[model samples]
Each structure stands twice: as structure tokens, then as C-alpha cells.
Target: MTIREAFTDLINQRGWYVKLEIPEGTANSTKKRFLEGKPVTEDKMKEILQRAGYRIKQVELWEK
Candidate 1:
């Protein structure tokens, strides 16, 4: 699934919301953009997943 889809699912499953210290207008705008399927940065995605108690692992595969 796409990142946006996964993010949405996680948010729904965990009832997660952005609670930044920014102004209400900016926060609302960000939420709107996110719901509109705007692309999220990789770093931001990692941060969110980490905050949700998820761990990321990288594994290398070699082909013979």
C-alpha cells in the first residue's frame, strides 16, 4: 500500500492526530493537505511510525 494509505490507516487505527505547537490555522491546513493525499517526506514518515511504537528494520538480500 502507498504511504498515504498506510498513514491514514495507522491514524485511524490508533486515533492519532498531530498535536504540534503551531497555530490552529496552520495545523488545520496541514491536516487538510494530508487528507488530500499530499506526499509525506521519508523522515517525517519514520518519525510518525516511531512515535506509534513501531520499529523499522532493514535487511539486505543477495542474489546468487
Candidate 2:
């Protein structure tokens, strides 16, 4: 399945709130790197967002 599809599936399966974050300060600069905008694939981004407790309660795409 596509990353977007996978994300949607996850949300549908689990109430739109995924948490995929490594414990703060556990990994030096890892969180920082993520926060600082490291490159990520759709699958990877989906995983991270899910781990970080971010759910797709709504889909909003802004074209600019």
C-alpha cells in the first residue's frame, strides 16, 4: 500500500493519534535533527508522525 494509504489505514484503525517519538534526551540530537527538518520519505515520515502521537484526524493540503 502507498504511504498515504498506510497512514490513512493506521488512522482508521487507531483513532487518529499515533505516537512515535524516541524518549527526549535519550538520543543526543536525534530529536533535534527531526525537529530541525531532516529529510524523510513518505513511509518514514508516516512512521515518525505516528510514533510521535500525530494522527490524521483531518486531511489538509495547501497548494502554494
Candidate 3:
């Protein structure tokens, strides 16, 4: 399965949050490359996930 599918399964079936942790000193640069100044929307996320062979077709909102 793709990384996106696996991650979705983690939260949906396992009821967990997928948090990525970076090395202590690399956090700042990593944020600038990924998190900083980047829009956190479905499209943007899908683009990032696509690099790992993830093609998001649909999204379901949960009350959890």
C-alpha cells in the first residue's frame, strides 16, 4: 500500500495520530523545506504524498 493509504489506515483503524519527528538539529531546516510557509490543505498534502506513490481520490471526514 502507498504511504498515504497506510497512514490513513493508521488513524482510521488504529485511532492514532501520524506525527513525524525529525532530528533535534534538523527540525528548523526541515520545517522550512516542508512545514514553514506551506499551505496545509488537501491538495498540498496530496502533492506531497504523491511522491510516495499515493494518489488521493477521496477523503472522509470523521467525528473523532
Which has the greatest lDDT? 1
lDDT head-to-head 2 vs 3, winner: 2
lDDT of 3 at 23: 46
Candidate 3, residue 8: how far the Cα is off, in Å: 6.9
Q: Write the per-residue lDDT of candidate 3 for residues 1-64, one digit (tens) a residue.
A: 5444443443343212223332434434433444344534555445435543546565655795
**Is 1 or 3 the stronger prediction by TM-score?**
1
Q: TM-score for every candidate vs. truth?
A: 0.48, 0.32, 0.28
lDDT of 2 by residue, 1-64 (tens): 4455554444344323324344445333433354456644566656655675566676666898
Q: Work out candidate 1's RMSD over C-alphas.
A: 4.7
lDDT of 1 by residue, 1-64 (tens): 5545555665555225444334556545545667777855767765666676555555435798
Candidate 2 RMSD computed on C-alpha atoms after optimal superposition onto the true structure: 9.6
Residue pairs with clashing backbones, model 2: 18-53, 19-51, 19-52, 19-53, 20-51, 20-52, 21-51
Q: How many clashes show up per model? A: 0, 7, 0
- lDDT agreement of model 1 with the native: 0.57
lDDT of each: 0.57, 0.50, 0.43
Over all chains combined, what TM-score does candidate 3 have? 0.28
